[model samples]
Target chain A: MRAAGGDGHPGPVIELNGLTKRHGGKVAVDDVSFTASPGRVTGFLGPNGAGKSSTLRVLLGLDVPDAGTALVGGRPYRKLRNPLRTVGSLLDGGGAHGSRSGRAHLTWLAVSNGIPRSRVEEVLDLVGLADVAGRRVSTYSLGTGRRLGLAAALLGDPEVLVLDEPVNGLDPEGIRWIRRFLRAYAAEGRTVLLSSHLMGETAGTADDLVVIDAGRVVARGTVPEVVGGHASLEDAFFALTEERGR
Target chain B: MSAVAAEWRKLLSLPSALVAIGLTLVAMPALGTSTARRLAAQLDAGGDGVLGTVTTLTVGFELVPFAVLGPVVLGVVIIGSEYTRGSKDSGGGRQITTSLTAVPGRGRLLLAKAVVLAGVSAALAVVVIPATIWLAQTALGEHGHTWDALGPRVAGAVVYWMLMPLIALAVTVVTRSGIVPMVFFVVNSSFVSVTHLLTRVTPLAAYLPDMAGTRMFTAQGPVHGGLVMLAWTAGLLAVAALVFTRRDA
Candidate 1:
């Protein structure tokens, strides 16, 4: 049931223009630019240390880009009022404190954005973590913690979803569940931008693809367009990245 | 206001924060009682010198400085918990990412946390100061002072307790980890007060935050001491806000 935000209104747009970030003397993201539009699952693919996390971090206002802009609905994340209600993001273990119960973790997040506490239970049930929501997150398995993180991301029922490595830790069922959930979510006219190194999964689930290597976008287009002349998306990924490497 | 409410909920939900409060509640009074009992025994033996001159009010006031350890821990944990990493199996993530995304505005997030820290520490002081005073007074028996006699000193202790946590908050923010500030503050509060020792080496040490803060309750110039400690807190928090807002999370 795509009841939440399924009114056919286009969700907020995520745009990064000439974005550059540096850590110490090294560049993490270099002149990166792309758009993740409503009604699309844009799979942000990259090798490890390819600046996917850095770009997402800047977009979420967790980091300051040395130059350029990362914006949601034409405003910087830091400038958005009640950002969570507009953009729900999952970055690194869902940003949860280990000592807190999953419900408590989501409760504070909801309270921060003035979201009704009832939504906490709804998201918990939606993510299938209702029975163990009261358990400390430290006790959760890797896959369970990922679900908890996903639960938090959906807590605010935002217009845009930004997730880094959303399926890093999940069983086969979980993988299938998220694949279906994200498709339904985007079908409701919401934006989804997820970063992962999983090429096969990206090929199967994502409508659009943006690939980065060494802090630069090497390719961008629909899944089939980027996979041009290649046997598969995985083959296309290696071809593009290896060529850049040389 | 919603941000503040979120911070309050966050601090309360942390098991470590709760444990710190519980331990402070039980430990502060116990420590006060034992100290008061020892001082009373020393006086009963007809001891001459500083021991003989110690009044019940003095006994109660002496315990106030040590009461700071609780607030220090509370402040440290409030911010420290944000930086604590989950297990490796859990993607080794920290809560700071979630916090930043929810609040977005760095200044607003830091302000919310400071407000919650101040509120909790002040509330803790209200419960703790009186409990410690009452227990210490009881242990002093015939020489015990009434609550009325300790009025302003109790107020000073509350302010002192409140400010100490803010100082801890600023330091923890700058350090971004609980280890350094936790070790330094806990050691200085309990075992050997490096700040206290520095006072003997140089009079300027009296102007230090902890020493000057203790003067709020123990010395003759309560207002002066409170102001000095407030200045230190304000200065450090300014630096913390700058560092926090300008840095990458």
Candidate 2:
């Protein structure tokens, strides 16, 4: 429903420069740096416990980085005049209240951000939830909930998308839909930073790949370059993570 | 302004806010009239309107517990619902995450919440008190009315209504749950004034928010009740603001 770069703001260049985050005595994302630029899908691949979630949280300004900056569009997320309009994000299961209808939840976000109600309806329709938008979110299935989260991220028609494990629980059809969606979104010259453990999905959907293990980015290159001499992306991913485990 | 509207809408979304408000508006007048009528004979004969028929008739009925509890409940709900965890094992903690992402500025978000809370509490008092005064006067012989005492008392009711919720809201902001504030304050208002009992041992207890707030209406206090309420409200808010701004969402 959104025109390509509809707001005319160039898709943001997301940068995590020497980013380091620690929880108590343990470090989560340690001195990691990367860039996700416009007009391409940058897949952040990492195994669980590899700190992909923490990095994404920092990137979205959900968690404060202990020692570095996570910048979008040349500024920290909190400094952006309208962050949601610049970067659409999906965090975990999304933060919809159980008591609120899907429409009400989106309505409040729209109100908070000054987005029109018509936009909320359009996002609902975009996510295939317009018919059930009146139902309390407590009734939605897991996949529907994810779609609702995606709808919120898109509410502002942002130039950049930062999503965490977006296809974690989707049906195969839903996963394929998301893959197609991300590809098309990046093709429209908007930045897409997606993290997933599913190598197959990332290999098929992403143009560039950054793989992390144990809170560190160990490899970065195009799909074929990372997969060099390996039969498939999956084999390369395991070999890389296994080599890092040593 | 948008944040304020959003906060108000968020408060309205909760069934608790609407139920608490509706019940208080209807219940206070009904209870005030019935109680005033029941004590009419003793109230009239007992020293010929000694404590002022209006005060004696309605103070016990409309002044504490029920009168203030609903507003107090709503105050807690405004912030408490955000801390409520959802069914998907998604904790209430994420709400702060979502809100911060939406608003970003910690100080602005908290300010919006405070303004909305005050506005809603004041609005509730406006709807409820005039009707309550009318019902009480009708039961006490319908001899027209006296604005002399009511001028201050209604002002006091407005202060009381606004203060109770603000107090509850500040605590909810700290504890991140309405349950504690709702239970403690509702009980403190209705059953036993913990602050009142503590006052016997230490008059300092009288300076606690509720007791000081009661002074607005009763004009009895160990200190200037309004100022005490102001100090406590301002102090609690300061602490909440500090924590909210410093902590990672």
Candidate 3:
């Protein structure tokens, strides 16, 4: 049996307690909450407009939540000095400008946070973009852009990784690499919170699940725990999201 | 300090910004000489020996309508360039998001930008002031002001060109596009007749940033021209700070 109280767990490194966000008259996230613990891959699954991006935005301090708190490392992300060195994040589309060269884009981000210039090259190599680093981002293919984004995310070598749809444009090889890399990253006692609708794909990687729909967490637990006697992870995901929480 | 340093690096790296700097440096001297000769001809026709006539340092104020164009573009380029593309939220392309995420302190980030703008403006002035003086003296020869007489004009010219664009920068913040301010500055600064007309209706229009900035060189300018320029800049910057902090990136 699993251990009970006094499990000595450090609790979650990423916490969203009673997070609520509204867009004018519309409610984006209605008091939804969850935690991403260390040394495990926590999958954030949802349908389109399910408030996945909104939650990530507030968590990263890109957008302020109307009510509730989103904290990283037990402190608001805004308070950290050179936050990239603490929580590396990869938002959708990599937040890149087409006119800026891939290397130059990373250079400014590195410079802004006072990260070493040499780290720029290191990340370029890490993301397998070393040869094309000098080319303008406009010419980059979607997969290439994703690799560049990943490179930027790894530039600070942060302990916690927050990624949104990171597997979107990757090929099978790229997806497998990410799966292996994220798993290995979690194995190193770091926190990995990945949001994607790919249930079966995430099944082999994530240690826990956070299924959200209609601006609330409908189901969240270990792989099978959320699956709960269902035929497969996807079946469980559909039940939790489409069926409006059984 | 790091944020400020990084902003400087970003300022230098921008290609459009480099073009603005190059244009201002080249055009100031190229146009200043021709302008001095024409103004010297005007002074002869007007029959006056005004101590600090616009022709005293032609490049400093006489042909300002055109000279101001380059620096004005440079100002607009500094802030508007960011909004040209990728400010959209569809992808992670909004530079503001990346910038604010890294800096977090909205006020400090904009202040760093302002400082970079000021530093670049001053550097350009360092080059433009001397070159324009030498060129104007050579072109206007006997018609030009002497060294002692030309001192304040040189100081005035630098401060004027450097501070003028900050007004445009603040406007760009509100418009969120450089195009609006760029067009407005180019058209407004190109022709003085419109300003003259506006000043007739409201004499205090003389205290506008452009006019107040010009006073740094003109004989008829008010005693508090610098303070007037400072007030406008401070007011606009306060607006930018308010809007930038309260809004969602």
DockQ of 1: 0.82
Model 2, TM vs. native? 0.92
Would candidate 1 be rated incorrect, acceptable, medium or high by CAPRI criteria?
A: high
Candidate 1: the clashing residue pairs are none
lDDT (tens digit, per residue) of candidate 2 on A1-246:
001121233544888798998988899898888778788888999888889989988887767888889999889988876577888988776777777788888888888888888999999998899999998877778788888889989999999999888996688999989999999999998999999988998999988788888888877767777787899999988888898665
Query: Against the unseen true structure, what C-alpha lDDT does each candidate score?
Result: 0.88, 0.79, 0.78
lDDT of 3 by residue, A1-246 (tens): 111111244768998999999999899998977888889899998887889988998898878899999999899988888988888888776666666788988898898888999999998987789999999777887788788888878888898999989998899999999999999999998999999978888888998888888888888878778888899988877766666642
DockQ score of the complex predicted as candidate 2: 0.47
**Interface RMSD, candidates in the order listed:** 0.7, 2.3, 3.0
lDDT of 2 by residue, B91-145 (tens): 2224566677788888888899899989988988887876777677667664334
What does the i-RMS of model 2 come to? 2.3
Candidate 1 residue lDDT tens string, A1-246: 001121333544988899999999999999998888899999999989999999999999889999999989999999989888989888866679989999999999999999999999999999999999999999999989999989888988999999889888898899999999999999998999999999999888898889999999888878888888999999999999998754
Each predicted model: what fraction of the native A–B Cα contacts (within 8 Å) does it retain? 0.94, 0.46, 0.49
Worst 10 contiguous positions by lDDT, candidate 2 chain B? B52-61
Error of 2 at A226 (Å): 2.4
lDDT of candidate 3 over B1-249, digit per residue (tens): 878887887767777777778887888787777777676676667745544533464444565545656666766776776565542323445566567667888788888888888877878876887787778777776677676877776777777777777777788888878888887887787754456567889988887777777777664453478778878888988898888777776
CAPRI accuracy category, model 2: acceptable
Model 3, residue B164: distance off in Å is: 2.2
